[model samples]
Target: MSFVLGVISALTAPFLVVVGFIVWDNHWNGTAFALNMYNCTMTAIGFLIVSIVVRQFVLEPSTEEEIFTSQKIGGLMVSSTIGILIGDWVWLEGLRLLGSRKIIVVDSLKPFLAVFLGEVFLDERLERGAIIGLILTVLGVALVGLEKEDHNIETETTIECESVGAAGTEVFNEHTVLIEKDNNEQSSTVVVDSYAQQRKNRGKQSTKEFIYGLVMAILNVVLHTFGVLLTKKYGVGMTTFEINLIRFGFAGICMALLSFSLWSISNISSTTTSTTTTMTTMMTTMTMKPAWYLLPDASYSTWRRISFGVVFVSFLQPALTNYAMFQISLALLLTLESIGPLYSLPLSYILQGNRPTFRACIGAILAVIGIIVLSFKGITES
Candidate 1:
């Protein structure tokens, strides 16, 4: 069920994000900064809400001074924020442009990149097997990106009827119908040639987006690795829940401030033409209304759904994963995370009825193998 939630969160969170950006872009010309800030702020809100609810109902609450005063906690907060901000923004961007499946596969490169970073930054020596594993991992990701997108599978339904004629002769009639149910949705009939052409065009666009997503995924992996390292280094004394709370709280505050500043600047610049306009804009801005930050064109229902997705993806997934992290070694944590694609791919098939191409499956296997090799090496060295 957790794995299913992870898959659902991965797909749904980004979809809502892409939709929010699309609506914002169409209406108010949204910037990437705004989108990043929005995501961070909302994520922070989700964490805070959960924390408060848990503290009130399930656990005793601790003082902010106790959590924030320690030097180690402060270091963890800063380092984790750097990692979370960069990794999250890049990941969301990848999701927005490339889609969930492709982005998830691309993210499997993290362990490989982390190994390389370790060799460079920590002066760690990589075993020959680890080096070979790294090579295989890169090759697998390349193959995945290069594999052709699967075509829509159509299901044909046939019906036959027979009737006896007045002259005692048997009359037969037959009917055939073709229906394509994609992702559990029935699609309207489309001409084969035209559909093929459309798919080809879409494939080209998807290829371009995949390349872009690949780069972003790599950057995300690097930043996320750094963040994890920072947490491991400075997070020895604190509980995982406390560290996460501080991280989220600090990050949320920073993003909220940045977002408010940007919003103010943009509004001020736009409203400089007339005193009346300035006054009205100032009043609207001073109110610190959600409408100023959120998409004006988006409906209440859209906001509610997006908020729910953000809560699940941002809060619940991380809470579960972080709790698990406290119980395991970093290498084991990473090795487990590296299997995200394996879960995502199969779950997509079961839930959406979208089958992966053969090449994709092979690529996922190779990447998993590479991560396992790296994990084994780390375990032995430690």
Candidate 2:
């Protein structure tokens, strides 16, 4: 059932994102207003569903890790998303001034960029093949993106899932376990501590969890790519925050009306949290990172500008992407995004489980190779 949901989500996600983007484009005229409205609306709907699910279903506190995850989901997450908007507004403004083509070209290096970020921020080692493959894939994806811009044909779609472990390490379930004794005969106690540290750094979630993480990661990449494309077409003048606000406004009205008419409405009004705020809170809580981490820092200007980046990353990105996929084609976008599996595979192994099987590794390698080939062939920007 979980796998089915994963597959369903993978299949539907890109279409939802593209459709959302298209609607957003129609409504907001490249301003943040459209994105905001869309975000708010979707968030309200999602929140209602989640509320119903939680209210109706099991609500057990499973373990210590789950407890930690829950704590992260609280107010800290919401504040962090607001921070992200502040930074994103600054970054988008820079991108606008810098121009779209350059921004996109820079954007093409996403996988490589992520790897670099991981190396710098988390001290993850960049493997020789991974680096080389990432470069090739980036080059290939760039070529494909360029081709897409020129020819404007739809892209293919695929889905890959990864699982995370408790210690934050990526574990690959597809591979056989390799047991190697330490050559540096350290004390057993120290060795145990080192192993524990390794796990913590890696983030070992469950297999199912790792897969979901991969899905979310792919969604992030796809949506950001679209954001770049949209920015190019509309120019940075479009306030994505406004788009989100409008989206949220409409979403709020709709959710309020619907909940009042059709569902059991909760008086979350006392919380004064909009659906966008709720989602921003939930997503940030899940990840345990500052929302501003996703955006660039611009000095405080208009309150809107200050909050723009955070709301976009935390709210608009998810909303537009969902709309895009909901109305448009999903296959191409998801297939392109599935290249995330390349990143997810190794990370899952290192974090969730041990290394992948020879076949799983080969599958991941081939996926990257295929992306490179596609890039060389060139894909449309749309």
Candidate 3:
């Protein structure tokens, strides 16, 4: 179950993120703070609702008041803010500065970073065979990531994606907030949300832009790796749902502040000259909410879709991943989880009927072999 769930998480989380951003782009025009505020809100509420169900009716509450002690709670809060909130913003920023391809490739390197740190910080060591397995996994994922050479990757007008994992650190990515054109009014607008709903229209990037993107991408990895390590340190004290409650609940509050700050800034300057200002203000004021529409349309059914990202990808996936890490090593778990495209490829073929390229097929096979070797080596080490 743990391994299966890990596989599911590695595949689904990134794509589901696209879901939450659908309403964001249409309504809020992809404000980073809005994404942050919205993601945190939905994330917290989703965990709260599920946690209540699990706690009240499914599982007994932990009598360990120490779980909620100031020290533990504080640690959890700090970790969550650093890992989820700031880290999330950073990766998306990287995406906007760079592009998804380079950012994703860089993100795929995070497991190795975590593994290296695991040894230095936690004295986590891997067997020789495990080391080889990690190399193979990273290579495979890279092959898959770099398989596409197309510069203009405008997907069919509608697409979906919600993901971040491989999680030696979460590969939180970015789409730089730019001034969005308001169709109702001709005035320029800027990105005011906390999330990157989509990659920017691709074009040649200057050296400085490339450098900035690379730095942000690497920084995003470092922060997320830190968060993952923190989880390994503090994750053992509570149930999965309990950990999630603390993690996302704290994130929601912090994200709200960040989002509100940007949101207020954007609105404060709106000139009363254009009727669109009033319309944008009214639209924002009314629509500033977590996507909760129950409609079945792929994009508009925001909450239903976000549930996949939140409940399965964030909540359950991490639990499974943590369990795998406990059984194996953090390095091994990172290697296995990092091959996200391996899992997503087959699902894409199955669901969308998009055939994989021969290149993709080979990459998937290589990653599978690496995963098997990693698992076997870890089991033997144990």
Question: What TM-score does each of the candidates earn?
Answer: 0.56, 0.36, 0.71
Count of residue pairs whose backbone atoms collide, per candidate: 0, 103, 30
TM-score ranking, high to low: 3, 1, 2
lDDT of 2 at 244: 31
Q: What does candidate 3's lDDT look like per residue over 177-215, in tens digits?
A: 221223343211122111222332234567787788889
Off by over 4 Å in 2: 1-12, 23-30, 51-61, 65-71, 74-84, 119-127, 148-382
Question: What would the TM-score be for candidate 1 when compared with the true structure?
Answer: 0.56
- Among the numbered candidates, top lDDT falls to 3
* Model 1 ranges off by over 4 Å: 1-39, 42-69, 87-109, 116-221, 275-297, 365-382
Q: What's the CA error at residue 268 for candidate 1, in Å? A: 3.2
Model 3 clash tally?
Answer: 30
lDDT of 1 by residue, 192-224 (tens): 333444435446775677688777766776677
Q: Model 3, which residues run further than 4 Å from truth? A: 1-32, 52-65, 148-203, 261-310, 322-325, 379-382
User: 1-382 in candidate 2: lDDT tens per residue?
Assistant: 4323333443343333332222221111122322332334545455445434653464543333322232333322332232222223333432323322233364554454444443443344433544454455545444433332222111111111111111111111100001122323444345345444443443554566445534434443444433323322222222223323332334345434543543222335425787788778677756542122122222345234323332333344444433333222222223444343344344434543534445445555555585444333322222
Better of 1 and 2 by TM-score: 1
